[model samples]
Target: MKTQNFKTITLLLVVFLTSTSMNLMAQDEQERPRRQGPDAKALADKRLKIPDLTDAQSEQIKKIRVKAQQQTLPIKNTMREKRARLTTLSTTEKANMNEINKVVEEIGDLQTQLMKHRETSRQEIRALLNDEQRVFFDSHMQRRHRGKHQKHRRG
Candidate 1:
């Protein structure tokens, strides 16, 4: 009888420990930060509350986002490569300032082109919006910018 009681108590303790460990692991996963891909449709949907966008406008926005992403990828890839090269050059025993400067300039040019492309896309999207939508869009953009700045400050 004593041996049977000890076995039962041990079984219950094992079950409790296993459940507790699993719950703790689940909580840890929930607390971890996750990286998410850019979802243009979801973003457009979020803007619906502010501007009350029509179906046509939502479709247009998604198209614009897709086109911009397509166009920007090459420039972004080139810039990333140039940055990597710069890092490699700087870490070498005989670092070449001239080559590093050139790569930096190229990266700047690429960045400028990327910004211009984005601005053009923004203008095209804005042209599709009505006056009320434009006002809300501008306010929404300002809020987003502020939120980004606040996040940077906190981090």
Candidate 2:
């Protein structure tokens, strides 16, 4: 009786441990964070042939990005609302190319302002960079702007 009881308890313990571990493993997988845009920034810094920025230049770049985002927030919100409205719209309503063009123009105008803002910010940062950093920075900026233009053209 004692040996049977010991076997039963040991078996129950093994089963409980197996089930708990599986649950914990499943929970861990669900809790994992999704990689997104900031991950791209890290990867860009790592894999790009560009020279790294000085601390001051990096801080200034961050500030510039923040300022540009803030300045464009209103336009972004407006565009979001327009897009949402368009999604709810019927094909006939959506086929109004002129209205769509107007929205595109508004977004383009905002994008122009954003580009200017980024340029100004880059200038501010450029002042703090060494010649090598400046070269890398210019290349980075050109690549970024070119990508943005291509994306907008597609949209």
Q: Quick one: best TM-score, which candidate?
A: 1
Off by more than 4 A, model 2: 1-52, 85-90, 93-101, 145-155
- Candidate 1 on 57-79: residue-level lDDT in tens? 88898899899999999999999
lDDT of 2: 0.72
Angstrom error at residue 98, model 2 = 5.5
Top candidate on lDDT is 1
Error (Å) of candidate 2 at residue 33 is: 10
- Which window of ten consecutive residues has the lowest lDDT sum in model 1? 32-41
Task: Give the count of colliding residue pairs in each prediction.
Answer: 0, 0
Candidate 1 off by > 4 Å: 1-44, 47-49
Clash pairs for candidate 2: none
What are the lDDT figures for the candidates, one per model? 0.87, 0.72
